[model samples]
Target: MSETGRLAVRKTYKLFVGGAFPRSESGRSYVVSSSKGDFLANAARASRKDARDAVVAARKAFPGWSGATPYNRGQILYRVAEMMEGRRAQFVAEVVDADGVSARKAGELVDAAVDRLVWYAGWSDKIGAIQGAANPVAGPYFNLSTAEPTGVVAVVAPPFGPLLGLVSVVAPVIVTGNTCVVVASERAPLPSITLAEVLATSDLPGGVVNILTGHTGELAPWLAGHMDVNGIDLTGCDPDLARTCEQEAAENLKRVLRPAKTDWLADPGLDRMTTFLETKTVWHPVGI
Candidate 1:
């Protein structure tokens, strides 16, 4: 094929829901541009209906994912890291073009994202031991408290450092056995869409990590107020949007994780995972 006569084959990016890639229900799409204003590709523009569909998918998968053995969950998360590692070059290029960073910086970001997944994978089986407690009661009984998943979390991915920020918020949520609906960075969603491909092929069950790409402001309110959604992570929203979403979340007393500015490469600790967890205590009669 002559260079002058060659035609570029462009890819149409789609939403990742229920372990399947589908175009937005609204049948809408928007052009994604590189940092240099070069046309990259067209990404599905998710609407409120799409957000609702994602929530339904997440809720459907919650029981199975949350009920899985801790070791099994850890292995699935580890598989995510493995799949991500295999696609490092693709992610690095997307990061570079989206963020206008040097190849070295993009590579570093992608590496950190992969390592972050591995870190969360290691925490899957350990969180219960670390967060649960045994208590001594002043009666003929034994008492214990355990941490459990808060179902159907909705995450808004950070706009800056799309890849790293995305992995940071998502890895912790799913590692703890909570299914989630995530809105990828509106300006730089290519890397996240690509990551969805990674998840689909990993050992993760369907709908465990549903991803959407589009305007956060347009879809956030619907997710925040969705009666079935158990938690909302507003890490990607601005002050006003975050506040608005928090207020909506109050209707159902949903767990709300407010946005905070932090170095994405810093040690994240266990705060993110714990934020969406509920503690349950049980008492058993002694010497029955």
Candidate 2:
């Protein structure tokens, strides 16, 4: 048989949960198309049950991931950046198809995404010092406050700039000790799942970051309403959907980040990583 007669091995795109690739429990899939309406592939349409399972996985992984030293988490995240660098070509190709841009433009987005990861990774160990404070009290006591992770967070990635937006949102949450269940951009999810493959191979523990593809409006509500979830970021949600999710999240008093005008290419600063964090303060009487 001639080498040219070989059949290509098609990829089965599925949900990334608990560090393993699994088909959606509902056994449902939807056709994914390029920006030009060309057939790209089929992606799993995650159901409510899948979202629940992802939250459970995140809760289970929280203790260890959160307890690891800040420096350690930063190193692991930096490793993921390294892996992404190795797969630069593949990411650029997917970004081009997903974002409907020329190869050169896609390459730039991919480069920005990789640099974004490193930026967040560098912040992992330094967040506490920057965000924490030492109080000046009237009494003979010492007071200090430091930031801590708010447990499992649900994220809705922005619909545009799939790779860059996704990286911008996810990197900040996990780099600061929070585990996340991200509902990827339905319109441009190919690069997201490919990112999951990179995370799975990295030193990151399972469930630290889970990616789900489906109707954003469908998944965001359940995550917002989930009692176990500590926060919700609606940067990707449309106004109506964001409103609905915000209402649901209020039931548990979850920290809700409403959609805002964001230029992903601009300087991000520290807001994204700080959004999902909580402050802890301690006081001690002065010692002789």
Candidate 3:
């Protein structure tokens, strides 16, 4: 076919919720452009209603996901890594176009993201063991504490280093059984939406990870104050926005993870996962 005769298929980036791709309820979309000022595609401009719907999906999927065995969750997460590996070239291209990075750097970022997911997958069954503890009591009672899922979590993915930053925040949240509503990078959302495609087909249960592409300023407040939402991660927000969201989260006593300047490529350790988990201590008579 002649170059002029060939038709290009343009993708309409939509929100991924409940394992399905849907347009914004408001029927709104915004133009996304390449770093070189060329038009890329139109991404769904998520609204407050979209945020509410994503929270509902996350809440509905919470029980099954949280109740699932840690080993099962780990396997599912590993499957995501496998799928991502298969789509490495696609993600690398998206990262390059979105961030204006060189192909080599983009490939490195994609590889790091895949590796990050695998790292979190290994932590699934071990986190509880590491975070939980047994205590010695003075009386004839047995006491032990264990970590538990904190229910639905809302994550604001970082604006820069889209793929690596996104994986860094999200892998830790869902690895421990907490379903999440993620706000993709506003300026560079293609990689995140593409990752959503990987999640949809990777044996991950629906609603376990909902990704929305839009302005964080429009959606963060609603998620912060959402009563059903158990936690919020502001790792992608600016200091002022993060502070505002933190205040809103206090309305329902939600666990708020404030934004911090960190190296996404550094070892994350247990802090990210532990921040969203709750501790439960049980005591019973030893002679029962």
Could you give candidate 1's per-residue lDDT for residues 210-260 as a string of tens digits? Answer: 999999999888899999999999999999999999999999999999999
Residue lDDT tens for model 2, 135-180: 9989999999999999999999999989999999999999989999
TM-score of each: 0.97, 0.97, 0.97
TM-score of 3: 0.97
Q: Give the lowest summed-lDDT range of ten residues in model 1.
A: 1-10
**Model 1 regions more than 4 Å off:** 1-8
lDDT of each candidate versus the true structure: 0.94, 0.93, 0.93
For candidate 3, the 10 contiguous residues with the lowest summed lDDT are 1-10
Looking at model 2, the pairs that clash are: none
lDDT by residue for model 3 (201-282), tens: 9999999999999998988888998999999999998998898899999999998888988898889989899999999999
